[model samples]
Target: AQSVAQPEDQVNVAEGNPLTVKCTYSVSGNPYLFWYVQYPNRGLQFLLKYITGDNLVKGSYGFEAEFNKSQTSFHLKKPSALVSDSALYFCAVGGFKTIFGAGTRLFVKA
Candidate 1:
């Protein structure tokens, strides 16, 4: 069985600061990791994925994540945060039946 854990319930950042949302996973075999963002009252939107290759993967909205195999962690990052970037983020791991972590809400203030 595979499971995803996001330790943070919410992340607060200044408007232009870099932001990160942590995620870790445990699985039987190699895991496929993904990040999705959900705006208020909206559906989950695919942000990025790490299927294979390059430890660092880039995705929509200037977001990127590092896939650390040894640590079993995939942490999402942004060079600079925006007020518009504030949203609920989810980290998921798996193939057919993906397991998603409890969402982390991002609050970016100007």
Candidate 2:
């Protein structure tokens, strides 16, 4: 069975500071990790993915993530944060059904 865990329900950050949303996963075989964001009354949008290659993967909206196999962790990171970046973030691991974490709400304040 594949599963994902997002320990925090919400993360708060200042508008200009760096932000991070943590994610951990467990899978039987080689796994595919992905990050998605959802805005109010909107569908989930793909942020980034770790298929195979470099450990550091960059994605839309100046977002990036590090894939750590030994730790089984895929933590999302942003160089600089923006108020517009505040949203519901989900960490997912692809396998059978593509299990998703409960979601972490990010609050960016100016």
Candidate 3:
């Protein structure tokens, strides 16, 4: 079965500091990894994706993720956090069907 797990329920970081949200996955075949962000009551906005290219993939809002096949992980990172960046982030995996993690709420304190 294909699945994704976000180990953190919430990640709190002060504005201007680097931040990271952990993600791990399980799949039967080749996997497509994606990161999305959502604000209150809003649909997820595509951040980035890793199909089959370089290990490090960059996306919108200065966010980037590294795909590790051996570890089955794709952790999202940013150099500096912003209060506006505070929102719910989701890591997803697509194979036969798409699956999303429970999601991690990021609170960037000002």
Candidate 4:
């Protein structure tokens, strides 16, 4: 079985400050990790992914994730968070079967 966990229900950050949305995974085989964001009444948007190669992977909207095999984690990070970045974030892990975390709502305050 493959599973991902977003321990925090919500992550609050200042508009100009850095932000992190933590994610941990457990899978049987080589796993694929992905991050997606959903805004109000909108569909999920791809953020970043970690499959292989570089441990540090960068993606859309100034986001990046570090793939740590030792820790079994791929936490999303942004150097500076914007109010517009506030949304629901999902962490997914998959080998053959894909599983999504409960989701973490990010709020960036001005």
TM-score for all models, in order of appearance: 0.98, 0.97, 0.96, 0.96
lDDT of 4 at 102: 97
Off by over 4 Å in 1: none
Candidate maximizing TM-score: 1
Clashing pairs in 1: none
- Candidate 2 regions off by >4 Å? none
Candidate lDDT (C-alpha), each: 0.96, 0.95, 0.95, 0.93
> Which lDDT value does model 3 have at 19?
99
Model 4 Cα displacement at 84 (Å)?
0.4
Give the CA lDDT, 0 to 100, for residue 45 in model 4. Answer: 91
Candidate 3, residues 2-108: lDDT per residue as tens digits?
89999999999999999999999998777899999999999999999999989999999999999999999999999999999999999999944679999999999
Candidate 2 displacement at residue 38 in angstroms = 0.2
**Which candidate do you rate higher for TM-score, 2 or 4?**
2
lDDT of 3: 0.95
Q: Write the per-residue lDDT of candidate 1 for residues 1-110, one digit (tens) a residue.
A: 89999999999999889999999999888789999999999999999999999999999999999999999999999999999999999999987888999989999999
Cα lDDT, model 1, residue 95? 71
Per-residue lDDT of model 2, residues 1-110, tens digit only: 88999999999999989999999999988889999999999999999999899999999999999999999999999989999999999999994478899999999999
- lDDT per residue for candidate 4 within 3-80, as digits (tens), equals 899999999999999999999999877889999999999999988888889999999999999999999999999999
Model 2: worst 10 consecutive residues (lDDT sum): 91-100
Model 4 stretches astray by more than 4 angstroms: none
Clashes of each: 0, 0, 0, 0
